[model samples]
Target: MEKLRIVFMGTPDFAVGILDTIYQNNYEIVGVITAPDKPAGRGQKVSTSAVKEYAVSKNLHLLQPTNLKSEDFLAELKSLNANLHVVVAFRMLPEVVWKMPKLGTFNLHASLLPEYRGAAPINWAIINGETKTGVTTFFIDDKIDTGAMIMSKELFIGDEESAGELHDRLMHLGSDAVVETLQLIETGKASTTIQAENDEIKTAYKLNKENCKIDWSQSGKMIFDQIRGLSPYPAAWTFIKDGENEWNVKIYAASFEAKEHDELVGKISTTKKEIFIATKDGILKIVSLQFPGKKRMLAHELLNGISFSENTIAL
Candidate 1:
């Protein structure tokens, strides 16, 4: 059978792996669609999307449309004569675009469908304390993540794993799943299962500043999960108050001790080499953290530069 003609759409580093795999396997990629260049960072210099960078390096036919529904963009996309469209970490598509290709468009989502179906699947899965999460390749429809599932690959989430760690694992797994789905489609052996609608579905909404704030009133385990879920980026944050001075701190790593504690929630207990905060039912031993305007460091190292007063508490 002739190789499938594919048009790839994505914007981040996660999508680069899948695009590379497809190219390395000698599949025909007719075009690559990615986000437009935008000013970013301290200097406000223009930065390109990861997909665009890779596409340029390979000299693939590229499209960076400001509007997906524009006639010019649609005309260019239609001219590609692509049999299938593969999306990884791209934005939602209009029906006209997704329905244009002969084989339809499929997206590589970070979680198993019908559950944790939203923008931040990997982070939300760990935040919700799930022990297992996986990647899924599904047909894209009008609604987000509400489409027929073509293939899925599951992986175990480590007890101490952060979202960043799981993201790297899923990135590779998702690439393999995308390649397998394409081959299955090319062979006329692809099958899909309808996603059932039910109340048991857990939605993975986008993370925001309010949601990332740590609530000391929760159990130690819950707080620990929150810290790990957002670790290394948009970390779980809390306000530390000492007398009249207050500062915001982000917790990157922590351990939970479920033993009963008499101290009030949010109270801080510190030693020369350790920092512990009281939770509703136990204690949270902070291992890694970052203070406002300071680089991330171990709790002991942070303690070396700053001292917590007897009345210090996390608000």
Candidate 2:
């Protein structure tokens, strides 16, 4: 096998894991392309991507191009003399960039091809209540995620798993998948498959704040899944009107109980032990929550402070 010179492009914690794997496997990472540092947080400090930080740590040559198609950036990339390029969790590439590498550019996507073939794949699969999802490595083309597939690996979505939980699992799993794909490419034993367009296809569009709000009209299980899908970040929230004061409550950990409810739907019921909110089908017991203008806390602790009486309806 010829010694392969590779250029890596990615920009998140998920991408960082795969970058580390390639480094450890003795793959010659000639250069790393990551997103430019931008202002973040209250302090407005310049924040570098996780990939950039990792690249600096390993003393690898790094590039942060604001525009991939710019002549200077393309020239710099060509200087690396890379035969192959790897992309993960990065923006769509231009033809000039993807076509520059002789061995062709390949992307390690988080979902199985022809399904969940968009951004936020892991989040959408769990949000839609799918039983399984996986990762894929494919050649890069002009169309987004529509290319000849190199290989794919499927994994079961564990019961009661949240998006964040599944994300961590796929990150490590994806690293091995990329390494395996590269091994096949090196041995010239890799084959390609055309993607199928069927009605069973799923997409992972980006999650918005409006969609994260909990809807009480849904069944307890559906509401629970929504909450779990968005938990820990961009959380599932509900509003409670306390007289004229509206309180935003972000619900994190919850469980569904199909118990006899004496109150109307969307009503708040509370005991010293738990705080249950009535849904269309059953009550959702909120084990963890955060009141407006306050940090996250246990339901028991929140119940002690806030007065969630009979008329306190969660929006």
Tell me each candidate's TM-score. Answer: 0.97, 0.95
Model 1 lowest lDDT segment of ten: 215-224
Per-residue lDDT for 50-96 in model 1, tens only?
Answer: 99999999999999999999999999999999989999999999999
lDDT of 1: 0.93
lDDT by residue (tens digit), candidate 2, 1-315? 656889999999999999999999999999999999999998999999999999999999999999999999999999999999999999999999999988899999999888988878887787778889889999999998989999999899976788888888899889999999889888778899998888878887888878788878887878888877776777788997756767888988888877676767778878886887888778888889898778899988987887755677887
> Which pairs of residues clash in candidate 2, taking residues 3 or more apart in a chain or in different chains?
none
Whole-model lDDT per candidate: 0.93, 0.88
Considering summed lDDT, which 10 consecutive residues are worst modelled in model 2?
303-312
| Number of clashes found in candidate 1 | 0
Cα distance off (Å), candidate 1, residue 88: 0.5
**lDDT accuracy of residue 166 in candidate 2:** 85
